[model samples]
Target: MKAKLITLAVVVVALGGGIALASASSEPGSGPPAIGVVRAVRSGTDIVLPFDAYRHTPAEINVIERATAVLARDCLNRFGLHWAPPTVDAVDTSRPTAAGRYGIVDAAEVARLGYHAAEPPDRPSQPQPPLDVLMVYTGKGASDVGGQPVPEGGCLGEARRRLEEGLPAAMPGERFAELDRELYLTAQADERVQRAMTGWRECMAESGLRYADVWAANDDVRWSAPEPTPEEIATAKADLACRTRSGLAGTWLAVETAYQQRVISERRKEFDALATALHARLAHARQIVNR
Candidate 1:
C-alpha cells in the first residue's frame, strides 16, 4: 500500500519529471488547448460516438498533429482566424483552460459516422470553446531510469539521498517495518518490491559504482567473514522487505545490477504499450478516411 504507492510515485516522477507544479497562469489562451471527452451522436441516433479518443502513442501523436492541422486550416477557411500551436513549456495537460478549449474531433471518422463534418474542424466561429491539443507518448519505454544522463535534479543518486533523508512521515503507527510485512512484501518476492529493487540496481550500474566504497562500507570483504549466519540472512530479507515498502529499496541497493535491469525493462514496456495504443486509434481514423 504505502510502499507501493511511494515507489510508484517515485517512478512516475522520475520518468515524467515530477508531479507537475500548478502554475499561477496556465490559461488556455497562453497554453495548448486541453482536450476532454465528449459523448455525442455522429450520424443517426443509431451511431453513438465518443469524440475524444484517449490514445497516447506515436501514431496517436500523429493523429493529434494531423487533426490540429486540419482543424486550424478549417477554422481559417471558415472563420477567417488562425491559431499558433502552443509552446512546449506552456503545455499543462493536467489542467486546461476553458476559454481556449478546442473541440478535437476524430475528423474523418466523426464525419463517416454521421457527425456533421466541418471540412476543417478548427473553426473560430463554431462557438465551441477553443481547445488546445495534447499528444502524449506513453508506455513502458517512458518509465524512469536513474542512471540516464539528466540535468541536476534528475539522477537516481539524488533520489536515493532524498529517500534516506526520509519521505513525509507515513500516517501514525504506519512505520516502514509494519508496512513491509503487512502490505508491501510480495509473497513471491518477484512481485513488487523486488522489481523496484532491480530498477534501482540498474540505475547504479548506469551511473557507475565504486567497489572500494561498497567494500569499505561492508568491511566484510577486507576484515570480516564472507558467509552470513542464518540470523544474518533472515535479517537481510527483512531489511530488504522493509526498504521496498518504504520506497527506500532503490536508494539502499543502488549498487545491485539485477534490480536496476528489471526496473528499466518494466518502464520501457509501459511506455511502449501507451505508444502502441495511440497508434491504433489514429490508424482507425485513417482507415475510415481512406475508405
Candidate 2:
C-alpha cells in the first residue's frame, strides 16, 4: 500500500540533554479555539498518537514495490521481452517530527552538512520500455499482446488490486492532512499556546534577540543564501538557546497535544477505518513478498 504522507504544522523539538522544547503561534483571533476531549486524557497529558506509527516503513514499502515489479516483469516476458524490476529507493518516513522543526538546532549537523543533509545516490534514469512491453505492463490500449487480451487494470494495476484486496480504495493517511491543518489552526488560537508564545518572545528579548516569533526568527534573508553565513549560524545558536530557556517547544507541545486529542475523538471512526485498511494492505503485500 502507498503510505499516506502528511506534513505536520506543529513542530515539536526533542532536544538533547533531556530538554524537550515546544513553541506555538501567538497570532490572535485566527479562529475558534479547540475544545479538550474529556476521555482522551491519560495521567494528565492527552493520549495523542504519532501519525507515523500507522505508516509503512521503508523496508515494507520496498517489499511492496518489488512485488509490483515482479508482476510487471512476468507480464512483459509473455510478449518475448526481457524486463528487469527497477531498483527502488527506500524513503525514511519514520521521523516523528519534520527536519529543521526548531531551525538549525542540530549544531553538529549544521557544521558538517550545512543547510542540507547528504542525499542518497539517485536511481539511474531508464528509458521507456518498448510499446509492447508498456502495453502489457500498463494496459496502454493495445488491442492484443502475445495473442491474449491485455488484462483489465494492466499488470501494475492488477498487482496493486491483489495487494489491496478487501481494503478501501482511498490512499492511506488521506484524512490526516486535513486533521493536522485543522488542529494547527485551532492550536494557534489556544489560550495556553498564546501564553507560551509570550513567554518565548520575552525569553528571546532577554537574550538580546528581537523576534516576534520563531517563524520570524527563521525568516532572515541570511538563511536564504546559497550557503549559511556566519551571522546565520550565530543567530541559529541563539534561537536554539532562547527556545530551550523558555521551554517553548515543550509548552507548545502540551497545548497541541490537547488539540490533537480532541481531533482524535472526533475522527475516531475514520482513523480506525484507515488503520484497518492499511493493515490489510500490508498483510497482502507481505504475503506476496513471502511467496
Candidate 3:
C-alpha cells in the first residue's frame, strides 16, 4: 500500500492584554529567535501582535521583530508568518491505517516507536503569548489605501479566512497576498539521522534482535545537548564500532551521515522493504481495515 501523510493547519489571532513576564537565557541551539510563539490579533485595519502565551527563543523573538519591521516598512505586509520552537507533533504508528493519515515509517518496529510533529501556528481571535513588540497600525493611510478590516480572529483564523476568501480585494498587488502561514523554525543537521535510526530499528526488529535500551534512547529523545562533548563523540564512535563489528555498521553509518546532511533517502529504501513484508502478512492476518 502507498504511504499517506496528513498535515493539518490552524490559524489564530492575538488578543487584547498586557502582562510582564520573563525567563532565563535560552540554551544555545535550543530554538530560533522569538522566545515564545507569535500570533496576530486583527481588529479593523489594525494588526496587533500578542506575545504573551507561547514560549519563544531569542532567535524566534528576533525573527518576529525583524518581520514586524519589514511589515511596518512595507505598510503592514499582510502575509502569514509562523514562529515555532523545537517540537514534533505526536503520532500513532502501530497500524496500517495510519499510513494514510501521517508520514509512516511502514516498519513494524517504527510503528511500536512513536513520534511527534510540530505545526505552524496561525489563527485569529486566539489567546497569544505576551508580545516582545505589539504591531498596531494607528494611521489613516491603511484605510485610505483600501485595506479592509480583517474579521475578528487570531493569526490562524486570518490565514484560513484569507485562503477561503482569497487575498484582500484591495491588495496592493495580486502577488502581495498569500494564505500559507509563515513559519520560523530551527535548523538542524537534518532528518538523515532519524531516517537512519528508523531503518536500523526496523532491520533489528525483523531479525528478532531485542535492543530495547537502544530503542528507548532514540525514541522521543530530544537533542538537549547543544554541542557534542568529547565524551559524546567518543561514545558515538564506539557505538559505530560495535555496529560495524556486528555487520550493521554500514547501515547505521549511512543513515547517520544522511541525517547529518539533512536528508534521508535511505529511509525510503527501508520503507519499501517493510511495506512489502507488511503486505504479505496482512493478506493472511484477516485484519479489518478501519477497526
Candidate 4:
C-alpha cells in the first residue's frame, strides 16, 4: 500500500499542482468531503464527487509544471546549455470529473462536440532540449552526465524531491482515486441506478435510439469521428433530453455521493492524512514557482 500510494502521489504531482501560494496556503482541504448528498446535488457540471477535494486543482498543476521547468532549467545550465523552459498554464477545469461518469451531463458540450473530444488548447511547441540536456533532465538512471554528477531521477526528480520533502513515505492522494473508482463501479451497480438506467433506456427508445443504458449511448462508436455528424448530433441531443427527463444523472450522482460519504466515514483517518499531505506538497510547489 505504501509503495502504491507513493507511485500514485508521483503520478498526481507529475500531472501538476494548483494555483496561487496565498490560495494554496489560505484554505487547505484535507480528505473526506463534508458536504451532504443533498447539498452536493446540481453542483457545477455534475462532475464533482466527494473525493474531488483530494484531487489536484488546475492551479496546482500549473505550479508543479512551472516549478519543474524552473528546476530543470537551472540544472541544464551547469553544462553550458541554454534552456528555455516550456510554457506552463493552469486550466480552468479539472478533468474526468463525475460529470461524464454517468454520461452526457452537458447538453451544450454534447450538442457541439457530439461525444468527440473537446479541442485542446493551442500551445506553441517549445524547441526540444539537446541530448545532453535530456540526459541530465531525466537522469536516465545514470551516475553522471558530462562528468557532472547527476542527481537521482535527474533534475526533474530533484524538483519532485524538494516538493515532496515533508510527505509521508506512502503519500496520500492516489488511494482516493483507487477507492473512488471502486466506489463508482459499486454505486452504478446498485439497484436504484439500474432502475434509473432502465427508465433512461426507455426514454431514448422513444427517439428510436436503442441503447442498453446511458453508457452505451455515450460510447456510440459513430461519435468518435473527428467531427460530429448531423446524425450524431441529433442522437446526442436526444440522449441529453432523455437523460434530463429520466433523472438518470440525478440518480447516479445521488448513489455515488452516498457511497463516497460512506467511504469517507469509514476511512476518515486515512483520508485526512492524505488531504494534509496534498496541501503540504502544494504549498511547497507554490513556493518553488514564486521563487
Candidate 5:
C-alpha cells in the first residue's frame, strides 16, 4: 500500500508594534545606523527574526513540499502509477497583519475581500493512486506488493528527513513567542505608545467612530456580521484614516522599537544564543534548497 503524505503548513504572526530602525541586511556597512546596545552586541545584524526565517518562506515551503512530492511520484511511478507535485508560494512578511495594526488600514482590500484573507488560487486536480500506493507513500504498513517491503518511514517521511536534517524539531515561532510577549508588554507600558493611542482615539472620535482604542475598534460588533456591511466598511476606512492622521502607526512602531532595544540589551545573552541557532538553521535550510 502507498502511504498518504501529510503536508504541514507553518504560519507565524509577528507581535509588537516596533519600527525596525536597523538595516535588515546581514552585511556590514549597509543601511542606517544600528539601534543602541542591541546593535553593539550583534554589530550590524537585526536582532529580530528575518522575514524569510520566521517560519518558512513560500519558497522554502515549496522546496520541502516539492521534495516530498517528487519522492512520492518516483515511488508511485515504480508501480506504473502517477502523482503530482504540490504548488506553493512564498509568504508575505513585509507588514504586520495583526488586528490592532492600523485597524484595517487597507480600505480597498476590506471592501473587496471583507475581513477574510484572499482565497488562494486554485490548482488543477490530480488523480489519486491505488490504496496500496498511498499506504507506501504515507508510511502506513500494508502487505508487501511484488515481494518488496515498503521503504522505512515511507517515501514522504524520508523526503522530510532529508529536507529537515539538522533543523530544530519544534516550530521556530514557538521559540520566538517569549521575545514577542516581552516586547508587547514593554510597548503597552511605554508612555509614548500610550500617547499615540490617545491621539488615535481622539482622531477616531472626530470621524464619529468612537472607540476606546485599536483593540476596541477591531472588536466592534458591526464587524461580526456575515458580510461587511456599508457601516462597517465606512468605519474601517475612517479608522485607518484617523490612524494615519494621528501618526499612530509610526509612533507605536518607534516606541516599540525603543522598548525592544531595551529588552534586547537586558536579555543580551539569551538573544545572542537564539540568533546563533537561527543563523545555523537558516544556513542548513539554504543548503537543502540549493542541493
Candidate 6:
C-alpha cells in the first residue's frame, strides 16, 4: 500500500489576503536590497524567512500549550471540574503558512503532493471537556460553575492574559507578524513580480493549462481529488518550470526581502523590544510547564 500525505488545505487560505507595496525594480530577477541575507530558491517545505525567528518552533508551541493547560486546569480545579487541554487556534501571531506564498516553487514537491502542505500524520483528537466545564471555560453561560467565579472569558481567556502580560501595547502579537502579512501582499502587487507571473501564466497556457495566476492554477478544483491525479502532477510540474522560467520565484523573493529589510531597519527598536518581551513570556511558560 502507498503512504498517503495530508494536504492541510491551509496553503490557499493563508495566501489569499495581500496588498501592493511601494514600486521597485524594472527587473523581476534583481537581488533583494542589501539589508539582510537573501536565501536561495527553496522548496515549499523548506521556507524560512528573517521574521521566522519570532515564530514559535514546534517545541516552543508545545510549551505554550502545556502552560495553557496547566493554567486552565487551575481554574477548572476551583469548580471541581477537570480540564483536558483543547487545541486552541494559535494565540501567538506566528507568521502564516508559507507553502504557496510564492506560488509553488518546488517542482518535486508539487509533482508528489500538488499544492498540498507536506504535513506529518494527522494529530490525535483532543479530549473534549464536559459541557458544564466548557460553559465555565468559555464564559458562554454562567459566570461561575457551582459557586466558583469564572475569570473573564473563562479559563482560556485568563490563560491568554497571563501569557500576554508585560508585552507592549500590542496584545497577543508583535511587529514581525504584522510585517510578514503585509510583505506578501506587497510582493504580489509589485510590477516586477506581476510581469514574472504573466510569463508563468503564458508558460502554463502553452502546456494547455489556463490559469489567471499561480494561485488560480493551484486552486483549480480538479486537484481536490483524494490523491494527486495525473493531471495535477503534470500541471504542478509545468507550474514549477514556469515559475523558474518566468523569474517569479526570484523576483517575489527579492521584492519581499527588500520590504522586510526596510521595515526591520525602520522599526528595529520596537521589534527588539517586542522580541525581548516574547522571550520573557516563553521563559515564564517554560516554568509553568516544568511544574
The predictions' CA RMSDs to the true structure, in order, are 25.6, 9.9, 23.3, 8.3, 10.5, 6.7
**Deviation from native of the Cα of residue 106 in model 4, angstroms:** 1.5
lDDT of 6 by residue, 51-103 (tens): 55555554566677678778988877788888666564333223335545665
TM-score of each: 0.20, 0.65, 0.22, 0.80, 0.59, 0.77
lDDT of 2: 0.54
Instruction: Rank candidates, lDDT, best first.
Output: 6, 4, 2, 5, 1, 3
Clash numbers, per candidate: 31, 7, 68, 10, 17, 1
Over 4 Å off in model 2, which ranges? 1-48, 78-81, 93-97, 100-107, 110-155, 168-172
- Can you give the lDDT of residue 61 in candidate 1? 40
Candidate 4 Cα outliers beyond 4 Å, as residue runs: 1-11, 14-44, 90-99, 141-143, 169-171
TM-score of 2: 0.65
Candidate 1: where are CA atoms >4 Å away?
1-56, 81-192, 195-284, 287-291
* Candidate 6 backbone clash number: 1
Off by over 4 Å in 6: 1-40, 84-97, 168-178
Query: Model 3: per-residue lDDT, tens digit, 184-262?
Result: 0111122433344455455555545434423342231342344444443333333333333332323322332222222
Q: Judged by TM-score, which candidate is best?
A: 4
Give the least accurate 10-residue stretch of model 5, judged by summed lDDT.
38-47
lDDT of 4 by residue, 1-291 (tens): 000111123235421322111111122332323323432223236556677676676677777778777777777787666678777464434443343456556666777776665554676667787777787888885677677888888887886676666665433344444556666776677777788788878988888889987666666777666678898878878887877776777777777777776666655665676677777677777787788
For candidate 5, the TM-score is 0.59
Regarding TM-score, does 5 or 6 come out ahead?
6
Residue pairs with colliding backbones in model 4 are 16-61, 17-60, 17-61, 18-59, 18-60, 18-61, 19-59, 19-60, 47-98, 47-99
Candidate 2: residue 131 Cα off by (Å): 7.5
| Candidate 1 positional error at 28, Å | 40
Worst 10 residues of 4 by lDDT: 1-10
Clashing pairs in 2: 21-249, 21-250, 22-248, 22-249, 22-250, 23-248, 23-249
